[model samples]
Structure formats: structure tokens, C-alpha cells
Target: MGKIVFKRLVEVQILHDYFLTMGDGISFFQRNKKEKEELLTQRINRGLYSAGSIFKISPITANKLRDNKILFAETSSGFILGVEVDEVIEAGELRFKPVHDISKKLDLSFSLTTKLPFFKSFTNLELEKSLPSINYFTNKKATLLNENTVPAYTSMPLTKTAPAHQAGETYEMGTILDFGGTIREANQRTDGNDPAHWEDIDDRRFVTRADKVLLPHNFKIKFKDYQLVTQLEVSLEDTGNNKIKKIVKNSAEPFKDISLNFSKIDENDKDSPNIPSGIYYLNLKINGATEIVYSILLDNDLYDYQNFGVVELGFEEVNSPYSLLDTQGFLKTKIEAGGQKVSHPIFEIRLKNRRSYWRYKKNTDFTPSEIAATSNHLEVAASNILVAKKPKALTETLLPFKNGTNLLLPTPKVAGIRVENEKIYSDIHINQSNGLLKI
Candidate 1:
């Protein structure tokens, strides 16, 4: 029925150990990371913990005394009854100075001399028990009071699709007449209707027009149908890692809303090649009701096999098999270390030349020897890559090769020969007679 005036009072309590706590002693205090530890504890202990005492006194009756630090006192009796002292300045105001001073004309008590600490270093020191409580008499009945200052509240409608507020924007609420059993407008209106009886309710009290009653009073709204979308675009990168990089984008799609769930797959062990490998997967979702799962695979570094072993071959070496063959049918070896005339299989085919020739050579008729050699080469390469067992050498030469295998080579299985393939799904075998690998 009346207006209520609300006054705010902020109390900051100073602890006796505040200065000591700030010194380089406590690990957290020195780090300054937990600076709020003492302050917050003081606030909780003095403010919230003493809410009943604070509400019953102070600005509610008397204001808090401001000094180097906050000081709480009782003003309900009108005079500032110093209950807690933070410094000598605060104690001086409460008449806690010595009575035997030169200016002894003022009224002072012996309690003040005994209660006040020696002047110099000071802190939040309580004197309630050391000093006697003084009763300061005052007239509370003389202060003017307004009975019409009662508390009133207005509902705050939740905003829907509203833009952020800008400077100078008007904040107004349309008037409402009886509907939700509550008066709608906030402040009193100026239009004169009831001269003697003025209700704290706004002048725009009743709905002025019939159309105004039908208009939606609340503007806030909630979405009815919502959805979410998440996608990961994967592309190949020509890097040493030879990995498929994925770009993830999540959205509610048309609605522009999305939710995400992140979890670590502790039990998921990935050993096979196909399934992507990662320690954790990010599960994306849309609104709590509708979900979109987006799996985030951890990234890793991988070395390319092609770049390796290239440096071992000299700079004069060609990059591909075709280039190597173009330079020389095969790498020329010393026939007899300073003698170039003799013959003893004086050259070896480079791996690059072999791969290039195999990649570009026209599909030709595969003789039985060529097929066998191709199979042997593929088996050996696979074994090297997967660390599997080497294939058995099945060499059958038409020439009178001693022991049925190549006489020059001691073992049918080329023990020293190292083979590797870079092409996708490549299978090659060596043919003894043809002396070449067939794919």
C-alpha cells in the first residue's frame, strides 16, 4: 500500500592476520591465486553469518563507520556506539582516547584509556569484552516517516529473439487490467482520476481499450520444433604423414543451434588398419532432445615411406625407375675392379627404375617364368611391409642350370635383395627365366 525505500550497505571486514597472510609464507597466499580466501571468509563470517545482527542494526538504524578499514558499530541507540574498532582513528571518534590528556575539557571515561591499544600499528581488534558498552540516548520518534513507501514488484517477461540493448533505448511496459490477478504497470500515472485516494499502482491501471485486452501481454516465446546437424569433411593432404585430414563443423543447420558431448574411449582399442585411431571421440548433439553425433579422431604424425631411403641413393640417382633406365639400362658395376672388359652380371636394376618401368610398361604376355617371378616379388614385398614370412623360392630354369636353380646365385631366395612397393594394392612376383617381376 506504501512505497518502500531500499538502501544498500557494503561491509568489508579486515582480518587481524591480513598483513601477515600477504607476506611470503603461505604458498597459496604468496602465489596470489587464492587472494579471495581470507577476504571471502571474512565476508561470509561477518556478513552472511551475522545477517540477523546486521539487519537489526546499522544503516537500518545507523550507518557503518568508514576508516582505513570497515568498522561495525551500533547506531540503533542514535549515538555511534563503537562495537568493533579497526584503527586508532575509529577509536578516537568513539571517544576512546585518554581522559588525562591536556584537553581534558571533553567528557571521557577511564574505560576508554584501558580499552584502546597503544597508538602505532593497528588492525581489526575487538574491544567488546575489554570495554563497557555505553548507552547513547536519541529521539527515534522525531524522524519523519512515510507510510505510503511500500514495496511493489513487476513481472519481467523472458525475451524472445530480442536484439541487445543500445544506449537511449526506451524501457516501457504496456499497462494491464485484471487478468492474472496482478496489477500490470510499475510506476504511478499522472492522469488525475481519484483526487483524494491515490493507489501506489500506475495511473495506466485499467486496459484503456477492448483491443488492448486481447493483445498478448507476454512477448517471450519458446521454440517448438528444433534440430541439429554435424558433419566432418575429410580430404587428402600431400604430406609426409599420408593421413586423411578432417574438418569438423557442427550446427543445428537451419536453426543455427548445436550441443556437444565429449568423452574418452578408455576401453576402445584399435589395432586394425581401417577404423580411425584416437584416444577420445567428440560426440556432438543438438538441443538436449535431438542429438547429432560427431566423432573426433585424435590426430597423429606418420612418416612417408617414399621420402625415406631416397637420401641413401646418391644425388646422381634418378627419382623414378623410368629415369634410371633412361640414364643406364642398369647401374654399371666394376667387372673386375679397374677392368671393364670382363663380364659377370656387371649391373643391377635400381628400385626406382623397376617401379617406374612396372607402372608404365604396356600389359604384355606373361610367360610362366615371368608369372612366377612376379608372384615371388609381390610375396617378398608384402612380407617386408607386414613382417610376414618370406615366400618359398620356386625357380625352374630351362637352361641346364646346375641344381635346377640359377647357378650364379647361391640360393633361390635372393637373401640380400630388399623390396618395397608404394602403389596402392600392388602385387608383384619374380619369374626365374624371364628375370623380371610380373604384376
Candidate 2:
């Protein structure tokens, strides 16, 4: 019975759509009673959309409805709704709230207030009533504040000793002090130790007092390439008497070492008198140009080694030639003995003995003994060794000098021609099998 009822309902909905599609206007009105009531409410709401009306409610009545879900009101009421007679009367008594009182709330002193006039409406007041004028000048005069004034004196008297002036004490004009034999004028309140407040009368005396005296000592200056320098001159001057003393003047071959000999008047003159002890200015000149000037004090009581010692100076030349030859492999070089028949010329070969995975077979022909007797005799031989099985990179090499002074020539770079079948070859050739081989 339930199924039959549902089937009839479905059939009715189908027929309703069919009639509407067939241009039948009566089918829409034939809808269920509930749907017809919803259509009527929608038409009434459309009329109310464009209409508005005023509402009048008391504050107590609005407050009661504030909690209502459907028709609720906020705590803040409109001016016409919540206004009371007492509140209106109290607002009139104050007229305006003083903005100056806000300083107390902000935790500031009341004396620091801007002192602005309170706000007031001019409508209720009489037209002839005058308003309070604002005074912009609020600072008090220095005289009324009991502040010190500038003195009329031209100069202050000089003090023989350092003044013990306090930190905040004020002084009149012409206040001076002889602080540690230095005349300094007090430009402001000073602690007497600060140099900024004092004006220096003699700058030279201050410099002399601050100058450091040195003992008599030997000086030596070295040049990287002394051959390029055409002339070198050094002099000593007595600072007190301005007496100049010639130290060294070299116009010929410039020596590598420039040293001062205090025992003699000059570097080469041993018979001359020794230099006296005093403060002297040492001046170094290169190519007739002043290179440097140094003040030195010589004390006779101190020994030569006890005083300030040798000072080594060097000039950097970008174009100077390097003393060592940096290269890889063997090098063959000759040394000219100036056509003098030389016998048994010393030859040395240096190589780093690094560990290898496999031992390399040494070639006997390139040994130092065999190569020393070759037609192209080697005066000095140095090179990196590279085997066919083992390869290595070239590292920096330092040439050993004879007697720690005479520098030897650097080793030359050499490349191997070929090596195969337990034999070393100096040239390349094509073997019988048409394969490249060393011979």
C-alpha cells in the first residue's frame, strides 16, 4: 500500500512538469498548499524591501531586549534613546575637560605643562568678553637665574704650577697655568690634565720635551739590487748646533751593505776620531733624493751593542731579476770561466725523494758522473726528474751559495727524448714496425 501511494505521487509530479511544458498556466497554481503559502510570503517580502519605518523605545526596554537572539540591541545606545537628565546637567557644569590634566595621568610634572587655555564655546559668552592671551616666552633671563657672566679682562695671569681646577668650576678671562713648564690658557672649566682646554705658547719646546733620546748604535741598510742605484749618500747632523757630518758618498759601484761605523769619523777611515755622543739626525739619500730622516740620540756611556742596533732597509723593485730558476725536468747549462781553463767544475743535482707505489729504474747514462764528463760541461746542474712510469710536479728550488755568500747558477729545464726496452734515447725515430720509439 505504501509503494502504491509513492508511485502515484511520482506520477503526479511528472504530469505537473508535462503540463507546464505544454504552455499550461493553471499547472503552477495547482501546486501543494505549503508551496503556495511560501510563494505568498516571498511576494510580501519584496514589498517590504523598499519600505523603511522609525522605531521608538526606552533605554530600559532596549536593555532588556539586548540578550534576545532574534530582536537584539547593543549596550551602546543612541543619543535619543539612553540620554539622562542628570548626565546632561553635569556636562554643562564642566563646559570642557582640561587637556593639561592629562600630564598627571602620563606621570609627568605639572610645572612642565604647556599652560594652554582651556577650551570654551564662545556662543554662550558675551561678545565683549576678552579671552586669555597665550604667552610664548616662558624662559627666565640669565641674570635673574644668578648665572655667571664673561669677564672683561684681556689676559689671565700665568700660574707657575699645574692648576688643580675642579671639574665644573668657571674661570674669568686671562686665566693661565704653567703646567709642567707648558703655558696653557684655560679656555673653559678643565681638570688641568686635559690638553684640549690649554692653549700652547711654544710648540717647539713641547716637541723637544717629548723627543726620545737614543744611545749610540751602528746602522746597516741593505738593498735588494744595489747595482741599479747610481748614487747613495748618508749624513749625520748635530741637532743642537746644526753641524753636518758626511757619512758616506758612493758614486761608483754601490755596495750591498750600507753600515755606520761610530768608532771612526767615516765608514772607511779607521784613523779618524770617534763620533761624539749627542742627539743627531740621520739622513739617507738615494740618487740625490732624501729617502728618509730619523732622529737619534747618542750616549757615550753606553756600549755600541747596548744602544739601538743596525737597521736593515731594502728597496722593492718590481723589475728586479729573480735569483732562482723555477723549472721542471733536467737542464743543461754552461758557466763561462772568462776563457780560463776550468777543471773539475762542481755540479750538483737536487731531487725530492718521495715514496712511490712502484720503484722506478734509474738510468745510468743521465747520472751526475756520466753527465759531468759530457762535451757540454755543466757548471751548475739542477732539475726535476720525471720517469716514464712515474710523474711528478716541480716544486720551488733554493740555490746553495758557497761559503754562505757566493750564489751559484740555477739548474736548467730538460725534457726526455725517449726511453724503452732498458735503454735511454736522446732522439725520436720510427722503428722497423712503423711505431714511434726513442733512440
Best by TM-score: 2
lDDT score, candidate 1, position 49:
26
Off by over 4 Å in 2: 1-217, 224-230, 251-255, 266-272, 300-439
Candidates' C-alpha lDDT: 0.21, 0.27
lDDT of 1 by residue, 253-363 (tens): 443322221111111435423323332222222233222221222222211111110000111323332121113222121123343322111011000000011111113
Question: What would the TM-score be for candidate 2 when compared with the true structure?
Answer: 0.20
lDDT of 1 at 156: 13
- State the weakest 10-residue window (summed lDDT) of model 2: 5-14
Best candidate, lDDT: 2
